[model samples]
Target: MTKYLISFEKGAMDHIPEADWPEVGKAARAVCDEAKDAGVFVFADGLRYDDGDVQHAVVDVDGVVTDGPYPESKELIGGVLIVDVPMREEALRWAAKTAAACRCAQDVRKFIDGPNNA
Candidate 1:
């Protein structure tokens, strides 16, 4: 089994109206349930959008520590789902389902050395 990450960029769903969130949440939860039923779900979570609640930590080679997210990137990971699947195609299929459920595009990528990897 290979572990894949299925995620979407922060603010990708900003256009969604607040009134429709319940429906969207339902759809997203359904996908998660399906994944769990299929025995592919490893873990999943959504991040808080508030910057005040988010703290970034960086450790330097000499053990120096800094705070803040990457200065060059505007996009953030809004949510993520990790799954252990047999192949890339299977991961892509899950990503498609997730995209539809979230009403946003998803980015799928395999982990270099995941839990299932020896």
Candidate 2:
């Protein structure tokens, strides 16, 4: 099975009104339930915009811990789901379902295959 990282971009979610957040939450929950039933879902979730205050930590090259999102961008990673699937097509189908549930667009990408993939 392959693990795909599905992400939702920032701009696509601007339509949501703060007042209607609860309704959105309900929709998300329903989608999650359907995903669970479909057997195509391994895991899924939502996220907030900020990662709190940025902090620098240790780095491997210098034997130190590093802080902040690696390679930061204007749009923060809002949410994600690690899905185990047989093919990209299956993963994308679930991704589309998620996008519909959130009433927003989402980007889906595959996890790099490597020795540590185990």
Query: Which numbered prediction scores highest in TM-score against the true structure?
Result: 1
Query: Which lDDT tens digits does candidate 2 get at residues 1-118?
Result: 7888877864567788889878877877787787678675677776654557664333678676766565554466677766778899988887887787788877989988987555
Which lDDT tens digits does candidate 1 get at residues 56-108? 56688999987657566556789999989999999999999999999999999
Best by lDDT: 1
Q: How badly does each model clash, as a count of residue pairs?
A: 0, 7
Error of 2 at 49 (Å): 3.8
Clashing pairs in 1: none
